[model samples]
Target: MANEVVVVMVPFLAQGHLNQLLHLSRLISTYNIPIHFISTATHNRQVRIRLHGWNPNNNLIQFHDLDDPIVTPHPIIPNTTSHPNFPTHLQPYFNSSLLLRTPVADVIRSVSQTARKVAVIHDSLMSYVVQDVCLIPNAETYIFRGLSVFYYFCSTNMNLGRELPFEPDKICQLPAPGESISPEFSEFIKLQYDHQKNHVGNVYDSSRIIEGKFVESLKRDQVNGKYHWAVGPFNPVEMDSDCLDRHICLQWLDKQPARSVLYVSFGTTTTFTSDQIAELALGLERSTQRFLWVLRDADKGDGSVGVKAAGPSHEKPLFDNYQTLHSTCRSVGLPEGVAGRGLVVREWAPQIDILGHLSTGGFVSHCGWNSCMEAMTAGVAVATWPIHTDQPYNAILLSNVLGVAVVMRDWEHRDELLTSVMVEKVVRKLMDTEVGEAVRKRAAELGGEWRKSMADGGVTHEDLNSLISYIHK
Candidate 1:
């Protein structure tokens, strides 16, 4: 009888995590392992809409949705740019991880009867609960850190006492840029770690659990244990060019001058209020730099309080120029002359092609993991503007540690209070400053390093193969 393998992926309630887990599933399923992707009901709807058209019902790939306790209380928040309700209102899903473990375990048990073994890939932030659940029979667990190798390297070496990884209080000598992380960025790193740590409870206990798991996995690898995998990002077992789209932004990019355009996006899951949108717009315009901005539509939950049909419409008047915008797309509004300024404001542009374009010189981004990876891979320097969650942390590492990026600010607010002056300063620095040039050079070099990391017999490739071998043992 052929041995079967079942893999369970439990990700945080965020788009970045969802994308990463799905990519991992795609990689492992190629080995003929049965993969079951688990997510909440709302997230499942999102997957169905965005990724469903891509063909998900193949023999090896399947998806499942679990119950969400706060479903009714948490109405779906729509994103004008990316898929709807993605990263905006992050419901308290940490409390639900344990609640989700049983249903997931039962699914694994049912699949394992016909399969050879079972594996669980847990996002690093939720590793504690996922690992606990994996004490079940034939189940192995691994933590997936959705960050770059640079950030990972910095994190592994952080000590919170004498020297915090990113505390502003230290005014001491800055850590080396690109070669090492500076104290300026370390405060944000430490803050992000604390935010995640708080969700899991006492830091000491959490560290103990994490350390113990690593030690056990190392020992298992020594004797070739059945429950160990150190996989990071995924690679196409075969690079089928046909599987990718080729003609959209690349053709446009082939015509523009190098280092002239700024690529702008807030990521698939993050959302901002209309005021914040205007502030950002003014910033972009005042900076006098040409850019491609992906703007999210207005969120209607707050205004939809009592009206049945007028949901987000009630709040539309708040935007001064909205009267000019037709509801043709799920947009809040576009300021006058926005279309004439060499700006591309589409909901979704061919990102891969755009990034690959020679004309695309820099990125003004939300510092999401996938975006960071894509930008680095494209050799594009970045103007980092982080919002919520791990974005600030990622921004710090990218700007201060790697020297490939520059941060606008680490603070985020729902109100549209930031003046146009702030945006002008950031935009000018990204487009014309000497700092920007240095960052661009370093980014190009790192992009090459990233390609090397995933090439055959590279660090990431070896890691993935070792993970697969460890699990099959």
Candidate 2:
């Protein structure tokens, strides 16, 4: 008898990457494909906790907690121990490949011999281990990128070890100019870009999950030579109860008029300097619009949120930014809301749910690919405020290419932050002007188009089917 296709998922340790894989795992399981969701001890627990009721008893999906007692006999899981050292510094993409080397090969070998036809689906960052993963009998490995297609395309095109043709100030403006990008910024992008050099265009030439013709145009490789498939805009996965407080946020939305409230959130792992936060606070207040703001103090960067060229070369620049921003954010105090129309939430909020609500007309976002996808898929217009990494690239994509979002603040390579004036102006423009209405309508229409893309015979659905056929072949 032919065995069922069993996909083994090995996501990196980041929440953003893990969340995407979990959602994708849920998606593939609908086809009755069994999955081996593997992670280190802590990450395995995190994923299991995320899927609380989804896979009880492991009937269809097996959870491999590599850090669990049975799998990890050692008293301590090697990578689970973390210190004040930030993630961007740890360089896990490079280290994790080495760490999972034997474990990944062992798991695939075990699964293939006994019951199922195994396929290894890992984070794009883990591409270094794909070659080893492919060593398993009849096994195939595919890279799953959690970032935007625009960001990916830019990375592939950039010349490593060479100066960009554009000005250093125009790093974010590959096709057009908006913000300044530091030399270190491109360095990080290059690091990620270089990882895919081995398998990206050659290995299943997997499809990117982003959905849009504009992104499609940037395709550098032949139809399937590089991007064999387009897998998304993956619907924003719902957060588990532990990750968010839904009832309070949803109840607040229930009382607002349709498309009247602005839903503001940067992302799960991102925080700004206090100055930027204060500017945002003032902007939200000045716009006179009903809004929901989800804030996390833990993510506040010391100004430079993890863009480093090497050891500590980039620290000083970031530290300077943090000090300036801290004083500014500290000096200002947010006023009480009138009639309790607006709300400020410090803990997590159900971003996907909040964006999808009828009352959410606009999103004040940091333009992370997932958040941007969520807002666009929900047909909610965005007031873009990109902070770092792929965010600025995504902001450019939304504002310049798709016309679904309005860029609130241009990204910068310097020590400056967005002032209240910029924030208030953009908020009012998004909430009170005809331009905002047009963008809002366009967002909804784009959302409808994306919905159609997910339907039968749609481009994304076809690619998904192609992946299935390849697996079954």
Please report the candidate that would top lDDT against the real structure: 2
lDDT of 1: 0.55
lDDT of 2 at 28: 75
Q: Deviation in angstroms for 216 in model 2?
A: 5.6
Where model 1 places Cα greater than 4 Å from the true spot, the runs are: 51-57, 67-70, 74-88, 125-135, 147-162, 165-232, 235-259, 297-354, 357-359, 411-417
Q: Give the candidate number with the greatest TM-score.
A: 2
**TM-scores for all candidates?**
0.70, 0.76
Instruction: Note the residue pairs that clash in candidate 1.
Output: 4-115, 4-116, 80-297, 87-269, 165-186, 166-186, 166-187, 167-187
Clashing pairs in 2: 207-229, 209-232
Model 2 misses residue 396 by how many Å?
0.8
Error of 1 at 416 (Å): 9.6
Candidate 2 local lDDT, 13-109, one digit each (tens): 6656766787777767778888888776666555444432134444567777663222212111111112111223323332443467567667778
